[model samples]
Target: MANHDQVLDASGLNCPLPILRAKKALSAMESGKILRIIATDPGSVKDFDSFAKQTGNPLLESGEEGGKFFFLIQKA
Candidate 1:
Protein backbone atom coordinates (compact mmCIF):
# COMPACT_ATOMS: atom_id res chain seq x y z
CA MET A 1 0.00 0.00 0.00
CA ALA A 2 1.14 3.50 -0.71
CA ASN A 3 1.70 5.74 2.25
CA HIS A 4 -1.16 8.15 2.81
CA ASP A 5 -0.50 11.82 3.33
CA GLN A 6 -3.63 12.05 5.42
CA VAL A 7 -6.54 9.95 6.60
CA LEU A 8 -10.14 11.13 6.59
CA ASP A 9 -12.32 9.08 8.89
CA ALA A 10 -15.79 9.50 7.47
CA SER A 11 -17.08 6.51 9.36
CA GLY A 12 -20.80 6.71 10.19
CA LEU A 13 -21.28 9.58 7.72
CA ASN A 14 -23.61 8.73 4.91
CA CYS A 15 -24.26 9.81 1.35
CA PRO A 16 -22.47 13.04 0.42
CA LEU A 17 -20.81 13.77 3.74
CA PRO A 18 -17.88 11.48 3.14
CA ILE A 19 -17.33 12.85 -0.32
CA LEU A 20 -17.74 16.40 0.95
CA ARG A 21 -15.30 15.85 3.76
CA ALA A 22 -12.86 14.24 1.34
CA LYS A 23 -13.12 17.22 -0.97
CA LYS A 24 -12.32 19.53 1.91
CA ALA A 25 -9.43 17.39 3.03
CA LEU A 26 -8.05 17.13 -0.47
CA SER A 27 -8.17 20.88 -0.87
CA ALA A 28 -5.88 21.20 2.12
CA MET A 29 -3.41 18.68 0.80
CA GLU A 30 -0.66 19.31 -1.69
CA SER A 31 -0.97 18.09 -5.23
CA GLY A 32 -0.01 14.45 -5.77
CA LYS A 33 -0.73 13.58 -2.13
CA ILE A 34 -2.80 10.58 -1.15
CA LEU A 35 -5.88 10.74 1.04
CA ARG A 36 -7.24 7.68 2.75
CA ILE A 37 -10.94 7.69 3.53
CA ILE A 38 -12.52 5.16 5.85
CA ALA A 39 -16.30 5.04 5.76
CA THR A 40 -19.16 2.80 6.84
CA ASP A 41 -21.79 3.78 4.28
CA PRO A 42 -22.22 1.19 1.56
CA GLY A 43 -23.24 3.99 -0.79
CA SER A 44 -19.72 5.33 -0.50
CA VAL A 45 -18.51 2.74 -2.95
CA LYS A 46 -20.44 4.46 -5.69
CA ASP A 47 -20.02 7.89 -4.19
CA PHE A 48 -16.25 7.78 -4.10
CA ASP A 49 -16.11 6.19 -7.52
CA SER A 50 -18.20 9.02 -8.96
CA PHE A 51 -16.36 11.68 -7.03
CA ALA A 52 -13.06 10.40 -8.37
CA LYS A 53 -14.32 10.25 -11.90
CA GLN A 54 -16.05 13.64 -11.85
CA THR A 55 -13.13 15.36 -10.19
CA GLY A 56 -10.45 13.66 -12.32
CA ASN A 57 -8.72 12.41 -9.22
CA PRO A 58 -7.65 8.83 -9.54
CA LEU A 59 -9.12 6.37 -7.09
CA LEU A 60 -5.96 4.45 -6.31
CA GLU A 61 -7.58 1.65 -4.38
CA SER A 62 -10.94 0.71 -2.85
CA GLY A 63 -12.15 -2.27 -0.89
CA GLU A 64 -14.24 -3.43 2.04
CA GLU A 65 -13.17 -5.19 5.19
CA GLY A 66 -15.10 -5.87 8.39
CA GLY A 67 -18.10 -3.97 7.07
CA LYS A 68 -16.15 -0.79 6.38
CA PHE A 69 -15.18 0.71 3.05
CA PHE A 70 -11.73 2.07 2.34
CA PHE A 71 -10.73 4.38 -0.48
CA LEU A 72 -7.34 5.71 -1.45
CA ILE A 73 -7.50 8.83 -3.56
CA GLN A 74 -4.61 10.58 -5.17
CA LYS A 75 -5.22 14.29 -5.38
CA ALA A 76 -5.33 15.75 -8.83
Candidate 2:
Protein backbone atom coordinates (compact mmCIF):
# COMPACT_ATOMS: atom_id res chain seq x y z
CA MET A 1 0.00 0.00 0.00
CA ALA A 2 1.25 3.48 -0.83
CA ASN A 3 0.59 5.85 2.07
CA HIS A 4 2.99 8.57 1.08
CA ASP A 5 2.61 11.66 -1.07
CA GLN A 6 5.87 11.14 -2.94
CA VAL A 7 8.38 8.39 -3.60
CA LEU A 8 12.16 8.42 -4.06
CA ASP A 9 13.76 5.21 -5.30
CA ALA A 10 17.39 5.25 -4.25
CA SER A 11 17.88 1.55 -4.61
CA GLY A 12 21.43 0.35 -5.30
CA LEU A 13 22.86 3.58 -3.98
CA ASN A 14 25.14 3.53 -0.96
CA CYS A 15 25.08 5.58 2.30
CA PRO A 16 25.28 9.28 1.49
CA LEU A 17 23.63 8.98 -1.90
CA PRO A 18 20.40 7.62 -0.52
CA ILE A 19 20.43 10.25 2.20
CA LEU A 20 21.39 12.92 -0.28
CA ARG A 21 18.68 12.06 -2.77
CA ALA A 22 16.14 11.91 0.00
CA LYS A 23 17.20 15.34 1.21
CA LYS A 24 16.86 16.72 -2.30
CA ALA A 25 13.44 15.18 -2.79
CA LEU A 26 12.23 16.35 0.58
CA SER A 27 13.45 19.82 -0.17
CA ALA A 28 11.19 19.97 -3.22
CA MET A 29 8.16 18.78 -1.24
CA GLU A 30 5.98 20.94 0.94
CA SER A 31 5.89 20.72 4.70
CA GLY A 32 3.71 17.89 6.06
CA LYS A 33 4.13 15.85 2.90
CA ILE A 34 5.52 12.34 3.19
CA LEU A 35 8.36 11.02 1.06
CA ARG A 36 8.76 7.29 0.63
CA ILE A 37 12.33 6.15 0.01
CA ILE A 38 13.36 2.77 -1.31
CA ALA A 39 16.96 1.75 -0.69
CA THR A 40 19.10 -1.38 -0.84
CA ASP A 41 21.94 -0.39 1.49
CA PRO A 42 21.62 -1.99 4.91
CA GLY A 43 23.15 1.01 6.60
CA SER A 44 20.37 3.24 5.29
CA VAL A 45 18.16 2.32 8.19
CA LYS A 46 20.40 4.06 10.69
CA ASP A 47 21.24 6.79 8.21
CA PHE A 48 17.60 7.66 7.69
CA ASP A 49 17.01 7.78 11.43
CA SER A 50 19.85 10.25 11.89
CA PHE A 51 18.81 12.26 8.86
CA ALA A 52 15.28 12.58 10.16
CA LYS A 53 16.51 13.82 13.52
CA GLN A 54 18.98 16.22 11.99
CA THR A 55 16.58 17.59 9.39
CA GLY A 56 13.58 17.69 11.73
CA ASN A 57 11.66 15.35 9.47
CA PRO A 58 9.61 12.61 11.11
CA LEU A 59 10.21 9.02 10.14
CA LEU A 60 6.68 7.76 9.97
CA GLU A 61 7.47 4.24 8.88
CA SER A 62 10.53 2.01 8.46
CA GLY A 63 10.54 -1.56 7.26
CA GLU A 64 11.99 -4.06 4.82
CA GLU A 65 10.54 -6.43 2.27
CA GLY A 66 12.25 -8.96 0.08
CA GLY A 67 15.66 -7.29 -0.23
CA LYS A 68 14.83 -3.61 -0.07
CA PHE A 69 14.52 -1.12 2.78
CA PHE A 70 11.63 1.35 2.98
CA PHE A 71 11.43 4.62 4.78
CA LEU A 72 8.52 7.06 5.14
CA ILE A 73 9.62 10.54 6.05
CA GLN A 74 7.18 13.33 6.85
CA LYS A 75 8.52 16.77 6.19
CA ALA A 76 8.48 19.07 9.18
Candidate 3:
Protein backbone atom coordinates (compact mmCIF):
# COMPACT_ATOMS: atom_id res chain seq x y z
CA MET A 1 0.00 0.00 0.00
CA ALA A 2 1.13 3.52 -0.73
CA ASN A 3 1.82 5.90 2.11
CA HIS A 4 -1.10 8.28 2.51
CA ASP A 5 -1.08 11.76 3.92
CA GLN A 6 -4.40 11.11 5.66
CA VAL A 7 -7.02 8.48 6.16
CA LEU A 8 -10.83 8.62 6.15
CA ASP A 9 -12.43 5.50 7.52
CA ALA A 10 -15.94 5.35 6.12
CA SER A 11 -16.52 1.80 7.18
CA GLY A 12 -20.19 0.81 7.66
CA LEU A 13 -21.34 3.87 5.74
CA ASN A 14 -23.41 3.43 2.62
CA CYS A 15 -23.19 4.98 -0.80
CA PRO A 16 -23.02 8.77 -1.11
CA LEU A 17 -21.87 8.95 2.49
CA PRO A 18 -18.48 7.49 1.74
CA ILE A 19 -18.20 9.52 -1.43
CA LEU A 20 -19.31 12.64 0.36
CA ARG A 21 -16.77 12.17 3.09
CA ALA A 22 -14.05 11.46 0.57
CA LYS A 23 -14.84 14.65 -1.30
CA LYS A 24 -14.74 16.64 1.88
CA ALA A 25 -11.47 15.09 2.97
CA LEU A 26 -9.91 15.74 -0.38
CA SER A 27 -11.03 19.34 -0.22
CA ALA A 28 -8.81 19.91 2.80
CA MET A 29 -5.84 18.12 1.29
CA GLU A 30 -3.02 19.72 -0.59
CA SER A 31 -2.42 19.01 -4.23
CA GLY A 32 -0.41 15.82 -4.92
CA LYS A 33 -1.22 14.54 -1.45
CA ILE A 34 -2.85 11.17 -1.04
CA LEU A 35 -5.97 10.38 0.96
CA ARG A 36 -6.65 6.79 1.81
CA ILE A 37 -10.30 5.86 2.26
CA ILE A 38 -11.48 2.66 3.88
CA ALA A 39 -15.08 1.75 3.20
CA THR A 40 -17.26 -1.28 3.63
CA ASP A 41 -19.80 -0.33 1.02
CA PRO A 42 -19.25 -2.43 -2.06
CA GLY A 43 -20.67 0.39 -4.10
CA SER A 44 -17.72 2.55 -3.18
CA VAL A 45 -15.55 0.93 -5.82
CA LYS A 46 -17.66 2.37 -8.59
CA ASP A 47 -18.34 5.60 -6.78
CA PHE A 48 -14.67 6.36 -6.18
CA ASP A 49 -13.79 5.44 -9.72
CA SER A 50 -16.30 7.96 -11.03
CA PHE A 51 -15.19 10.50 -8.47
CA ALA A 52 -11.55 10.25 -9.49
CA LYS A 53 -12.55 10.72 -13.10
CA GLN A 54 -14.88 13.67 -12.52
CA THR A 55 -12.66 15.41 -10.01
CA GLY A 56 -9.42 14.80 -11.92
CA ASN A 57 -7.86 13.26 -8.84
CA PRO A 58 -5.92 10.18 -9.71
CA LEU A 59 -7.04 6.92 -8.18
CA LEU A 60 -3.63 5.63 -7.35
CA GLU A 61 -4.75 2.23 -6.19
CA SER A 62 -7.89 0.34 -5.15
CA GLY A 63 -8.67 -3.12 -3.90
CA GLU A 64 -10.38 -5.15 -1.20
CA GLU A 65 -9.13 -7.11 1.74
CA GLY A 66 -10.67 -8.70 4.82
CA GLY A 67 -14.09 -7.84 3.37
CA LYS A 68 -13.37 -4.14 3.28
CA PHE A 69 -12.72 -1.94 0.28
CA PHE A 70 -9.88 0.53 0.12
CA PHE A 71 -9.07 3.42 -2.18
CA LEU A 72 -6.07 5.69 -2.49
CA ILE A 73 -7.14 9.02 -3.98
CA GLN A 74 -4.68 11.75 -4.70
CA LYS A 75 -5.78 15.35 -4.70
CA ALA A 76 -5.72 17.02 -8.06
**What's the CA RMSD for each of the models?**
0.8, 1.1, 0.6
- On TM-score, the candidate that comes out on top is 3
Model 2 lowest lDDT segment of ten: 1-10
For candidate 2, lDDT tens digit of each residue in 1-76? 5589998999999978999999999999999999999999999999999999998999999999778999999999
Each prediction's whole-model lDDT (CA): 0.94, 0.93, 0.95
- lDDT by residue (1-76, candidate 3, tens digit) is 8999999999999989999999999999899999999999988999999999999999999999798999999999
Ordering by TM-score: 3, 1, 2
Please tell me which model should have the higher TM-score, number 1 or number 3. 3
Q: What's the lDDT of the predicted structure labeled candidate 3?
A: 0.95
Please count the clashing residue pairs in each candidate, in the order shown: 0, 0, 0
> What's the residue-level lDDT of 39 in candidate 1?
98
What stretches of model 2 exceed 4 Å from their correct place? none
Between prediction 2 and prediction 3, which has the larger TM-score?
3
Root-mean-square deviation of Cα positions for candidate 3 versus the true structure, in angstroms: 0.6
My TM-score estimates for the predictions, one after another, are 0.95, 0.95, 0.97
True-vs-predicted CA distance for residue 3, candidate 3, Å: 1.0
